[model samples]
Target: MADPVSVDVPHKLGREAARARIAGGVGKLADMFPGGGTVEEHWEGDTLHFTLSAMGQKVASRLEVFEHHVHAEVDLPPMLTLFAGKIREKLAKEAPKLLE
Candidate 1:
């Protein structure tokens, strides 16, 4: 395991709307990745737990949905550390659309 690539992506759509958007866009979300991994989501209270696996690596994240923003902490495997910056950059660029 490596230090996680954490991000807080703000969304104008409140918590409920954000959650609905995420839940409904699971397939589109998967397609964002090169290999299109499987997505499994579980909720604990207001936090959404997500696991995306592909090419033997798993990215686990906890999304805390708030009234005006969504906070996410992502744990990336050690092997993927080298691409952390690129991954974070891509996520930052794509997050707004995903949350909308």
Candidate 2:
């Protein structure tokens, strides 16, 4: 089995706001990629746990919201690096719009 490749991406948003935005984004992604996977969200204190899985593979994202920003760490399959890259690109482009 391959080790999961992790990527950390930070977003500029408050804790609650970041959780809302990430949940919405995950919903959008699920809608766009139906049957591709399942997305789950949960919060423990200030940390938000988000996960997507399919075909025995999983992508996990942990969001830690600080006073000034939200730090997100995404772990995915090594073979799916391109897909992850695309997600990062999309998030970089669309997150600000969603936050606004």
Candidate 3:
């Protein structure tokens, strides 16, 4: 895989509140995808682990929640490497809202 893209999204809600908000907003994101997809999510202590598979591409991500920030690491499939910038931009824009 290409080097994983890392994004640090800051939130003012504090870790617990931010974690709750992110978890609740995930279902809304499912409806925004162009085509239907499967998202499998789990938690490892305070970190959230997720795998999103759609249109033959898979993105595995881990979000580490902290008091004032959430650090996200996304592993994009090789085929999707070229779109990394767009993907990062989208995440950079949306992550904060999700955490809020």
Candidate 4:
């Protein structure tokens, strides 16, 4: 268990537009990893709750699409925590593209 990794990407798109763009790309979240994985996605109002399981690690994440930004919080396993900074950095860089 490790602390959650939080990343935010600012966007000019409003909530509806941002949400639509994010919804379309979220299905491919698993593909970003090497071995790929299954994602169980659930939505609660404006927030997306997703669990990614791959290579014996389960990463539970919450993503919220706001009017001005998208925010993500990933709960990584201990093994993955070592790379949390890198993961946060990458997410911050790529999330905005999804909104566009």
Best by lDDT: 4
TM-score ranking of the models: 4, 3, 1, 2
Clashes by residue pair, model 2: none
**Mind giving the per-residue lDDT tens digits that candidate 2 earns over 8-99?**
44556666776677556655543322134777878888777877774456666676666556555566566566566565665555445434
> Using TM-score as the measure, which candidate wins?
4
Better of 2 and 4 by TM-score: 4
RMSD (Cα, Å) of model 2: 3.9
Clashing pairs for predicted structure model 3, backbone only: none
Point out the higher-scoring one by TM-score: 2 or 3.
Answer: 3
Whole-structure CA lDDT of model 3: 0.76
Q: Compare candidates 3 and 4 on TM-score and give the better one.
A: 4
Instruction: Write down the TM-score for model 2.
Output: 0.60
Whole-model Cα lDDT of every candidate shown, in order: 0.75, 0.58, 0.76, 0.81
TM-score of 3: 0.88
Query: After superposing candidate 1, which stretches have Cα over 4 Å from the reference?
Result: none
Least accurate stretch of 10 residues (summed lDDT) in model 2?
27-36
Residue pairs with backbone overlap in model 4: none
What is candidate 1's CA lDDT for residue 56?
A: 71
